[model samples]
Target: MARPVISCERHSLRGLLAVALALLLVCAVSAGVSAGQAGAQGLTPQQLAGQRVIYSYRGLTPPQSLLDDIRAGRAAGVIFFGENISSPEQIAGVVAQLRQAQAESPISRPLLLMTDQEGGLVRRLPGAPVPSAKQVGQSPDPVAAAFDAGLGAGRNLRGVGMNVNLAPVLDVFDTPGNFIDRTQRSFSDNPFAVAALGSAFITAQQGTGVAATAKHFPGLGTAPAGQNTDTGPVTLPADLSRLRSVDELPYPAAVFVGVKLVMLSWAIYPALDADRPAGLSPMIVDRELRGRNGFRGVTITDALEAESLNAFGTTGQRAVAAAAAGMDLILCSARDTGQGESATTALADAYAGGQLDPAAFDQAVARVDALRAGLR
Candidate 1:
């Protein structure tokens, strides 16, 4: 079923209807009430929590345990790595199997099958978006290059039955040979240029019906040489001025273009919040990214099992922490279904014991529901 589009125009119904409805959608989606809350009304705490967990697995075929979880509506979705996929044909078959499992689910929406299909070396699949973000940004016409890359990426992902692309890295790097720049993950050092290309890419990619995720926000560009959150603890003591002016400048443009999701950086920025990583900081998630930039879409965490989170405790504990921080999707990317299972159990426990607010949890689930419904 399509989401109802009602006009929010108070005075001039004819001239202002489209703009008002679009604004209303972005606002409602951000607030997490309008999309599909009815679907989450009676869900058990376990199921409600389960709807927030994104799972991963090792090797080609998915484990029976993951399949069983999906069939029981105890899984939100799955993320794919190159290891989980051998070829387009094999992955397509696997997606068909997962889809069948989802069809048996009570959620009545498509499972979010996602992958890191960022252009160039970052892609898991062997196809378009063949150029890196650096290449696109440096091209004669960066905007056009970005659009093509995004269009190709969306088509490629959709063709394989995947609905989400964890891509279009919007991190604007400051120094050359830095983490993001060295990896060719950044488009440009100029925030506005990055914003233009990022917005173009988002527009084209999502235009192909595959959701595009603008990642590592409120920016990972501050990480200097040899710093990587995936490996270990990385703290960026960037000044607040630079963080907002250079690193975070692209975000408002991304939000304006209607990016479906924004993945938070795991790196701790003391300027934003002294204690927790950005992904686990409501100050960043709730204040900077959503409140300041006006991003109404779902917010996702980078990874639950990152080595940087070692001090944060077990997989389940990390899951609770991220959720309490307002991360809608618990990304268990350890290639272990058991990891996600732990997260779901912990989330349910959190919800049950009042560690997580009921209204907030429902809103999270409803936002997730809206995203899933739109995917179908």
Candidate 2:
């Protein structure tokens, strides 16, 4: 069955979502203070656009250009990699530097300092969440292990001045040696088990003030053993029923537990919308995620530099498309300052050029602000 087209801003559940978003603004955690209210007023078009982007850089120290972007209100936050950390103290100092820069800008809220701290080999930082999700599931006490991993990850990230951990993967793979299972990423093949573990992780992690992201939705369990979305495109052809019953099963549990962010996948889902990736599809993002499941928190893209998006044109074009499709934050993790600038500029152009709806854009930026409001 084909999905009927609907405006991203015209969902029938607007009344309920407004209340949900307001609650999101009230749940500040981890560090700093909630200086940001849920509004995008007094911002220039470019600054408004900048509030929707998360930038990244290479090496140990972030470039002055990146700091300048923050100071100028042209950046919302940044994602970190292992290459950017030498020690906990070093990255903590780097976070302090960025925070000071952010203080000078119009936006006074804490910058979303984040990393892929999913545990085991996937963590960017050096410690905590030592056990993989797969191992946790295979343990005698899976629920306890999940909570421990989440608590460990949250404390680890918060101690280093970081606020978000892109972790607790909820992908429910079907077979052994599959992509998620092979990397020890997914908790279990059972959707109910994934839901319980993921909820436990979220509850424990967010209690420590550092927010956790439930990623690669609507689930990447079907991704092949060797096919990576980072290098190229991969389409999962699961039917709508299976996608809802299995892939999307854990999301409701996560949302109920108040997960701060959700990272959508670049992989295309023919059952949802075959024309574009889940992150760039209105049916998948606005309809399936928001309208159907009521996930009103921040929606982040997987990574803007993925080779899977070559067909979508350049960074600016892609950013505009994602934003128009109801995504709130664009993750540009190429480790190049220029890549981020390009995306920021393109979004500013789109907003200024009337390519994006004013009401919806403001609402989207406010949603990002709402997430930032929950952070220190």
Candidate 3:
């Protein structure tokens, strides 16, 4: 016998309940999937495809345009200057506010807040009751002094919610008239002393959960007399033996002790790379520091907006080139006025135009991510 045919209009109430229940299950599953995607941290390949670093004007507060770019993961980092400082309390407030904005941003990663707290003339938080590197170097026990000073500086910075301190000028300070060293920013003229004090500072700062960066790497210690690399393209005429002995000594010590960031100098080292400054030379960054030196941390460029590279290219072009040359971070100090903004925008444009290779960009982002992830 043929089974009784049930018309659609005559469907049982039980069948209707089952259909409704199935639909509800599907909706619940869909909702979960959407939530998972929303909760994911970091940017997708499409998001970071075309991005760069930017700076804000002091006393003007962070602009909506800059904030929007950062929230969209189009900006890399911010470089703080002396003008960005008011008082320790005020500085702390600004740092906290920046972090809050980052937390609310769609990008889940933390914003890299950088400052040139290298002590003496380069210090951002001056008069914070901390001793200069010169003072630490002059102490009978330089290592102990550096450790204590670094601890104090780290505590003060961490209290203010800052995570990075661009410090412990690795430059040897051989030139007595050198502006950076004449002001006592360098630890010592003796390479061993510099290495010892620098390593101590790195340990002490990182010990307190603040990442310490060794600055002006490959040794700005050998700059020409009466010339600062900040204002011009200074060159050092050291032989390979001199560089290895005096310039490159402190770097290995810094790496061996776990310093997380190293900032490359903009000065030219004819002995190393005559055509390009260390900041823009792949041989210096990739071959020398990364390969020969075996440094596995993040490498940043000194301010691209500095006069050192003003003749080479626009701030944006220099920044893009630095990244291509293997720098993980590009600094654009506000001291350059609006140049930082232009450079950052240029980097964003480069990313969009495919001038920056995707693989290289991803590699940089990954290294930065790893270093930050390991931070306490």
Candidate 4:
């Protein structure tokens, strides 16, 4: 009966439909396999690890080792320090060489040439445009002055081929002789004043196409005896409510004005998390800075080589911990290439071994890439 009913057109159509279905299934299986292999094969370990690290090197131009690292996609950027500077033109030359080296790498994202150009003593580049944060803070029209200062700083930074200026110290330290105030870094003891001034600087810098960083998050204003975290571990004794009201005040304003990055302090806050430094604490990095304060910018560790992290672990371990804690950029500004290389290696190993949270790593990289994209 079926033999009498079947037509050639209908028989051919059925065969084609069956073939299409098989092909679709095969494609789906192939895609699944590729996705499964992606974690191990899609991105090299160096790429994953290097994307998270910002390193410093010795000499006017980037060292050959650094150039090799850049070419191999094993370095994110170079940070300029006091020794790396002689003049604006000299720094410009060095940055030009870095870009030239980066061109050899397959990664198209521009290297984040950054410095602690926060004005006053912290300004790494010579001839910074703005005066000390104290000078700006105490100015007759602080907001406007800060705006001008930020503009000047941004212009100078961009002039030398640097794209990121780690400035606008947002700490609200009120304690007499605290490092934040003594260094002329904090805008003011008053959080609202700090907020206003910091926002102005952030606005002006980013407006000039140079990204601004609001630093030492949650405040270092109250460190007893002006205790420096760089020499050893220190704790912020303020309770959660005080920290929110006092220490964290400046960040919201900075966030409101669209700061591009927030430098996490190495100082531990018992109110946030008692056991770990802020840069190594999820409660401080993810919960407080990102969640509570609504800072959507990149999260960077202050410096991995800081002695504050000595109690925690070695530089490599600290770097991995910082990433796991939610930091996007690992700052290895101590002038030792080994520290940066070792840290990158450790991070890559951790990610490859499934020691780091995959979601966290992806989010960190996304934020970092997005920030870098802003420079381009």
Candidate 5:
């Protein structure tokens, strides 16, 4: 039969109804996709393991292996050493490349480019952050000097595109001529002075958008001379009372100043936990650093390859142990690049094998993700 011509108004009405139906279908599909993503919001086993590690490479350029790790979301950040830097501009370029790699990753959070820019001999970057910690500590106005020094250091660090400064060693210079003091890393021997000056430095640095890290937690200045944890395990003999009074004195002040991270010492603190080093001890990292001090920021372990952990396990094993111990970040700063991958794999395996507590693992990843969220 011959088709009858439809009225223009009826055709237009049908067209509008068809468009509305299409729009409704589109909305339904979009909502379904979003719901699926929301269901997958929790980190996968690999990402849960990977987000906890900050790795190092051998040369100045970002290596293919490290870049690959970033692309796979297997790296948390990078730590630059004196050897990786020749000049400020060169370091800036390196940082840019690292950041570009991070940006291209599936998980595009800002990568933490950090260095030991504590000023003085310990500074990885060239030039002065102005007055070393010792110089600031001994100055006429110690607190003001420290604040200015932190500002100067923060400017330099930010100029290079680095977000974290492994600086402001808050450990009071206890064992003179020891590792920290001989290098002029500590602010002072007096806890009160350390607290005041350290707090000022932390506030100023973080104010400049570069997070400050209080290092060698629970104090490494009390360790015996020449017994550096990097070379060998050393035990601190302070009792619990002295530990709370002296070793842990500066930390509370740093925490009060909103220090973003604290690096646990590798050295065994008998008073805190005689069985394990602070970095691998739950008593120190979980109960003490997280609970007692009430620091809600990130807790990073000193180098996972440090000699102090030699008897503990291999690089991967130590990384897993540190994470299991409640540390949020596992730093693999050894010369080899493979250690970083190994650490990631080890962490993933531990969680997958049911060795790590799922709740603790989730909490650790949440803290790390929170810190990354604060990055610019």
Candidate 6:
């Protein structure tokens, strides 16, 4: 048998197969470890561990500690006020830094950079303000102008690294003396017209990757006389039928157009719930908007730090209560120079103390994650 000699080629082939198998085993072990790490770091723990705290930033550059907190998944989102903005370029730079910090975070979720860019008086970024919704409605081609304005606003916001514009006030201008409408924020007293133009605005906004929020839902335009819902108790007088006809018209239109965020009003609709504002009312937030209207989007509470809510409870308590009432984001509660540590600690305490249901918290986090995924 010629010394039973094995060919050099066969020996090389056998060695190659052994090396290949070793490599594959090593790769499989590495993959298993990576997957196990990911499974161990599931979102449920993070979601149930704390509340999503949104704070305002005023400095030209965000502090490194603040950025680190965001990167560590300690903060949820940031809102920029007029004090934080001097010009569009400055705003852009600040937002870029924030986004960069967010990118470096362990979690890859989108960091919500939000502003009240509704135009007119509520505009946060100056030198690029579009006319109010009312002004857009004043144009003969309201749809075209509204669309252009929305596109323009979205472009401006996106230019500065903002993903959300708290805009397109859907409140019908039924009351002439209403502060928001008096400032020309409302589109029209006519529900149909408001619906049409508001939808156009939302379409333009979302068309450019900037999510538009149809705000003060259930309609702040119907707030009782001598009351600004942001400051005091607000009562909506419209019956369900009337609400469906007027105040609720633009919301569904926006929803139909695929709006990503809806901001609940601090205003209380006596017909809907006599005790709590829309933001904290289960009947209104969970039942009316989420259930009745089929708005399967992220629902945010109006600034929890607002005076109207200050009368109800401490900022931390209000935040936990609002989350319980179906709000996904707690905005404007940051203490300590827009750091939001107090609010974050408050939420963490609530979670640990069993005041907030872990399941409910997880659901809200899932909704927020879904919204961010859609953006991606």
Tens-place lDDT per residue, model 5, 92-121, is 998988888888876757888898888878
Model 6 segments more than 4 A misplaced: 1-51, 127-129, 333-339
Query: What digit string (tens of lDDT, one per residue) describes model 6 on residues 1-376?
Result: 0111112222233432332233223211111000011111554334333326676655666677678777777666788877778888888888778878778866677778888888767787774446888887676555556666777778778878888889878888887777866788987777766766676667667777888888888888877667886676667788888887778877766676777788999987778888888899888888889777778778888877777776677777787788788887788634343426656666777776778886676667666666565453
Error of 4 at 238 (Å): 1.6
Count clashes in each candidate, considering only residues at least 3 apart in sequence or on different chains. 1, 2, 0, 1, 0, 0
Tens-digit per-residue lDDT, 71-127, candidate 3: 666555566777778887887777676766666666666767767666556577765
Evaluation by TM-score, superior candidate among 5 and 6: 5
For every model shown, what is its TM-score relative to the native structure?
A: 0.91, 0.90, 0.83, 0.87, 0.88, 0.84
Scanning candidate 6 in windows of ten residues, the lowest lDDT window is: 27-36
**What is the C-alpha local distance difference test score of candidate 5?**
0.78
- Model 1, 110-133: lDDT tens digits are 999999998878999999989999
How does candidate 1 score on lDDT?
0.84
Which has the greatest lDDT? 1
Task: Name model 4 segments beyond 4 Å from true.
Answer: 1-41
**lDDT for position 12 in model 5:** 36
lDDT tens digits, residues 36-137, model 2?
A: 344666889889999999999999999999999999999989999999999999999999999999999988777999999888779888899998898887
lDDT of 4 by residue, 303-329 (tens): 888888887788889989998888888
Q: What lDDT is obtained when candidate 3 is compared to the true structure?
A: 0.68
**lDDT scores of the candidates, listed in order:** 0.84, 0.83, 0.68, 0.77, 0.78, 0.70
